[model samples]
Target: MFDLPPWQSWEMFGACFYAVRINALLVLGLSTVTLGELLPGTMMSVKTRSISVELLPSRVFRCTDTFGASSPQRISRQGNPLETIDWTSGDWIAVNDDNGVGVDIFFTLKEAATDNVVVFVDQRKRQFGKFQPCHAKDYIDKLSVCPDFLVARGARFVGGIMDCVSPSNLEKFVVPDDCFILSQAGTELFTALWRIIQRVRLSSPSTRHAKPPSRQCFKAVRKKWIKSLGKL
Candidate 1:
């Protein structure tokens, strides 16, 4: 017979030892396994059975006290200030103040529901390191009020923000308590946002200087994004 590889041999030995140990435990009444289910084959069969687990849905919150209200009151949760901005259908870009530090520009997509609002952060502002402690707190606090999840770039930057916050504050004010979920930015999301911006720029009748992309150029960009995603 052909010899098994060294790693494979060790794995087989480990499995056999585990089985024997389990069987011995069953015989000595040290395990919960029934007398009828003492065989290793029976144990394996039981383990292979499909298990059903129910996951609870995430809690959704209202963005403001009144629906379609232009100015919503700032709410407080666990001693942290939750800022609310006026609802906007177009891209809202905010510039840095005289201090050269300000909130990143965000695009308010739509009201997912009467009470829930979906907001998207500009992927260009992935520079988490550039944010000072006060800036980070301001950014995160604003995100806390969004009823729907916010999509942004830079998973590493998100992790860095989480690391900066204390564990108790993170759990109580940021994650489940605040009903916020941070999703890692994907190529598809970025491409979709880019396409929307391009469409808006070209479709604007007022912008006579804006040039639309050629069919070939559009195809090239699409292919490049597809290839990048495929590599990932």
Candidate 2:
């Protein structure tokens, strides 16, 4: 089977549960408020590029298994990829791999000299994939090809980010609404994280996560469907 690009393939939405500690720190003012929360009045004008990639069924399964599940009362077992992506790309100005190891994929715009952006996805080996509603439209004006689909033999949604020059005199450019920020904590966080980590660690490249509260297992040759933003 041919897998299209994940960006054009599915609309998967799941918050990274790992941000609980980071959120706690931010809430307590331990860390600098993410660039997204900077005072809007002092913001600057800088072109920003954001990419939202939906991991194929394989990648999503690995991630949820690594973090566990989401819960309100307890610290969420899930880790928020949004926050991680924002921190690596937005704050650090570099895409990061949050697999707790090293970054996997890296990308850069033609304008920038030094490639600072890095990207990662959580998934397993497959034929190919695709993505719809690509973010490339924001930057590119004239396009020879519309990124309605993405193709790859195997998809991996490990964590990563993109980096670029910090716009001067542009604090506004420094912050974005998309920055990862959410409040969650407690025993729930521990359970979720532990379970997820275990899931990813134990996952054989052939498995998938389809269970509930956070399914973390799947068959190698299966295609999963997720809700699209516009359709939902």
Backbone clash count for every predicted candidate, in the order shown: 0, 67
Give Cα distance to truth, residue 199, candidate 2, Å: 22
Worst 10 residues of 1 by lDDT: 51-60
Using all chains and alpha carbons, the TM-scores for the candidates as numbered come to 0.21, 0.17
Candidate 2 wrongly placed segments (more than 4 Å): 1-13, 16-21, 30-118, 124-232
Candidate whose lDDT is highest:
1
lDDT (10s digit) by residue, model 1, range 101-217: 212222232221232223322111233343333543455554322222132211111111212112122222222121122122222332243343334335434322433435554
| Candidate 1 colliding pairs | none
Q: The CA-based lDDT of model 1 is what?
A: 0.26
Query: For each candidate, what is the lDDT?
Result: 0.26, 0.22
